[model samples]
Target chain A: MAALGREKMKQLEAQYKKILADYIVNQTEKNLYIAQNFTRQLIQKNISPEDVISIHKNAIAEIFPDRMNEAQPAYDFLIEVMVHYGMAHREHQSLLQKQAEYEMEMKIATSIQKALLKTHIPKLSTVDIGMLSVPARKMNGDYVHFFYHRDDYLSVAVTDVVGKGVPAALCMSMVKYGLETLEYAYKEPSYVLEVINRVIEKGVDDSMFVSMFYGCLDTQRNMFSYASAGHEPALHYNAKQDQFVALEAKGLLLGVLPNTKYTYQEVILEDNDIITMMTDGVTEFRGNDHLNSRQIITSVIRDNKYLSAQQLCQLLYREIEKIHGFDLSDDFTVVILKK
Target chain B: MASKSSVEIITEWDIVAARQLGRNEAKALGFGTVDQARITTAISELARNIYLYANIGRIEIERVDTETEKKIVVTATDQGPGIHDIRKVMEEGYSTSGGVGAGLPGVKRLMDSLEVQSVIGEGTTIRAEKWLR
Candidate 1:
């Protein structure tokens, strides 16, 4: 009877040690299964690391009060891992907030740029005008303005700044204001360009400059006088000859010199003559073949000479889009005046 | 040591590209924000001049590190009408075009060193460098 009692006491002691070891190491089959579910619930409830550590301490104290003091290193490792996770979570949350703020700002900027680009082509009996502007990004750097002066002449200007995004858009608004305010100063294209250069030179930054082509069309005499300020050569289509000739003029870009000289050239418009002024974006299209975009432009105008001004502009845009697979590399703007 | 990248300036978009590439190069060379902005602005001015005068050009950015310091060198070249009077073009208020007359001079002020070479009717090339402080 004594031997049997001793064996039973030994068995009970062994079982107690096994339970304490499992609680310390957290490595028994039953303990591991329970812990997996418990940890998932803890994470789902968003329990902080501090609360989790305290809960673990209390559980260990309740089961094996004497062994709780021995699990210090294991507890420290768990705390370290939890702290790292918390930091990463906070960083992710802040990143998300920053992204949302950036998106909102971009949305507002896009709307403002859209509002500035809103322009309508004037209706006239002597000539038909068509214009289109497309931004490569959310904002554009190309600008076009038209003024119907005193029912005798129509003035049109196309300008492209050497930057993009918000700065370029802001500069475009300044160009618009300069054009509007200086329309009454002179009816000559060269004089108008000089005035605009002075205004922009005073207002704009040194790094920014504008390339522009401004032209005035006399309704009664069918005469066109235009000036170029480092802009792309405007194409003049001779209807009688069925040939496209570039109206090349020499001048410096605007906002570069305070008092620069701009020279103007005169052309007599004939029946069914078409004049197209465009930014470099139209001619510099790069695609599968770097298609001679200028050639395509001239040919399109030649083929569609019978169409109305609006239709011709649409056809030209569509042809260019086809060549580029609808992926424009830069901002595109074109103004067409047909008589 | 030298690490180099080149951007083609054919239009306004190319000007932006040149600026971005320059800024990236400056950043890679451990330049601070102000230095990077200065490098980019200088690149913009040079590239814009090329586009305005030459119609097409290339901007090359290089990172150079010597035993003592690191530096970024930017070179803009064009095969268009070369400068007739280099001194006049570099003057702050003298411009052939109706510009603010700040292209070359502003670039000179923003950079540590500037070298301009041109031959009439051949082309123009401008090299500007900024040393990391």
Candidate 2:
């Protein structure tokens, strides 16, 4: 009987050794099964949970030498904790990958938006055209387009969408399409707005709208016909009168109502006369003291009426920037047409 | 009187913006994950058509809520050359640009309702809607 008991003890010791060896060698499901069975045997042999935890820590150290310095509690926690940690690490890696992909997409989108705002200005001999557009953010909601329809008619449009960023930029692109397509068929400012309003009403959502100023210069007749769709009034500098007049044409904002009627106002331009059309960013700029910005714009045009169109535009922009300390809160756009 | 939003489609990047915005609007309207994906895909196809055929266009998304159910509406309009044969364009596997030809028809299949109006020399407007069941 003594020999049989000693033999049983020896077999149990051999079985435990084999289980630990198998767990260290492969760490597979079969190894896990063996370890579980060995744990039960240890419990049956009156081994304390503390002793089991120590054994597990030593085995883990053998498998992962780099983790030997890690803090380990004396309690016998579930071995599945290690598997959970592995899975969490993998999930973190995948999340970082997805974040990188999103950043790349945003970068590409920003570049495309920037390209859309870089429009080409047309050159005309009869009138000097000066324009500037600066976005508060990476994407601009302001839009301007010049169409030289046949050599006799020069059409220029300036538009401002209600919002900013990607959505606003997208709305501006629609305005571009509306202007291009309507200009092909109509030259009258009111007719152009009528068609563009219909297009916007059909496609634009109620949450958004656009304010636009469309003007056509008949070079032969020296007549400028313009219409406003709830946009800021254009400033006209009469060289002979030596005064500023606001060209206020009334119409509803585009996309607000269908079949909206817009009336066009015509102006006869004399030599050295100037017409300045700007978005609200200029007229609505709040200085340090909340000074009236519209008055400042008018004064600037009145003071710089003698300068060339390009010089006057730069001067006005500089003055506005100086007032805001070079930090503008909105997108700024100005189109200056001088005869 | 649903909440509405609009985006312009000029380049390929605008198409991505439209898709993303559409998905967000649908989600805001309590659309399911499958419905959001479907709406986004339809926006992608419509925005791409604007860039391909019209050179420029606009897309509008709105959320409609009634006493019975909720719905999301999307409208796409372009002043480019309009479609000649509306019936053929709506048919599956009919493409004028050598593509898979599943654009308009695929959008129709994904949405609950689809309406298309085209003037040969003027432009085309397409409106699509999905209802949350």
Candidate 3:
């Protein structure tokens, strides 16, 4: 049995030598074929080339049992395969690393853009606000922010950038900057929106627009002045009437056209009156009975007018949760100001 | 100068206990002033999140070494509901659990550095550092 095994080893060595001789004639082609075959075989058999090489090397080591003298060719072949495998593995790992780096950069950029757009609410004497937002997706173009430049007046605005994901986020950032710039450029609500519209129109592509509701609250005077650029209606919950009322201003959305004019409306908000402002994320929600978002919100407010702004927001969220069974289609934000 | 001046506590998955632990630690670390109330608030927020989200968790408190620029490091770990969307979690007002969506964001605001690691169905670890000096 030992004699026959030696003969078999000699024959296998001869076959290996013949294959090496054939490979030596075209080294590049042979190497290319080896790589391709390795990949194909790995995919086909769900096995790793390294594992195959390891098993082969271990078998040779057991049979010949000598590092320097016996099984040297097998050892050399294993080394070559390992080197080739390492290079291929390194390339594959590097490709994955590059993709991860690209994704990381995208997230950082998106976060920076979000930071620019989602400015925290500025404290003002005119109002006590309870605001909450829950994005239904990774990036929502919905924006809610406040600016208090003057001591007696504070400006609150909510805008929905006209898309979703990263592009919408970028547009929202542009609108935020435009609003900040408009604060310096103009003061009246209508004119401020006009300047913002021009700024965004110059900055954004033709496809983009912003639906906005902007208002200035005068606490001492108990008056509220606001303008709308084709945004969703603002809900005015009269503490006296104990009902929710929608306030609409007639105007085109910002960036829809160059030099579009906006209209301003004025109202008196006395003690304990509530003004609820929101994006379409609240009004456009679909419910279990397939009721549109507007009906759902109106019904919720009608049923629960005694709840605080924060409480109302929570109730609305819970109702939506029940309606969609825990799926939200857009970013939801609601700001309730109690006077 | 005292290495063991600060006390540490580990408790079961009770959100109330975690909040108490956070407040106690923040006070022990010398942030008891009313102006710095947010520091304790942030700590409580993080601890509450961990307790509510995980079945088991741990909290460690160490005195801010004045020699090391007076930085306090607070870490919260949990083995439940690994944040599959960390980026979203970090975003302001984004919460899967019923909250103002302010836990992570508020903690980030209070601390100088915030690092989080989470795996789906595995676990989550949050590290927050607040500068005392």
Top-down DockQ ranking: 2, 1, 3
Record all residue pairs in model 2 with backbone atoms less than 3 Å apart, i.e. clashing.
Answer: A170-B8
User: Residue by residue across A107-182, what tens digits does model 1's lDDT show?
Assistant: 8988987887666689888898899888888889998888886567888898999888888898888888888787
Q: Indicate the DockQ of the complex predicted as candidate 1.
A: 0.01
lDDT at A288, model 3: 42
Per-residue alpha-carbon lDDT of model 2 for B51-112, expressed as tens digits?
88788899999888777878989999998888878887775445334432236765775677
Poorly placed runs, candidate 2 (over 4 Å): A1-99, A287-289, B1-133
Docking class of 1: incorrect
Give each prediction's DockQ, rounded to 2 decimals. 0.01, 0.01, 0.01
Q: Which stretches of candidate 1 lie over 4 Å from their true place?
A: A1-72, A81-85, A287-290, B1-133
The TM-scores, one per candidate, come to 0.59, 0.54, 0.52
What TM-score, to 2 decimals, does candidate 1 have?
Answer: 0.59
The residue-by-residue lDDT of candidate 2 on A1-339, one tens digit each, is 111243564565556666777777788998988778777876556443333444555556555678666534321233223322322333344456778997898788878876765678888888888999888887888988888865678888889999988788888878787777763655689998888888888898887899999899998999999999999999888989887888999999999989999999999989888999999988776645578877898889887777877788889889998888899888899999999
lDDT of 3 by residue, B19-122 (tens): 45555555666752321344454566666666555646665554465665665566777677788778877754353344322357556654567898888787
What is the Cα-based lDDT of residue A136 in candidate 1? 86
Per-residue lDDT tens digits of candidate 1, residues B1-133? 8889999999889999998899888888886444565678779878888777788889999999878878999999888888778887775444334432235755775678898898888888899888876
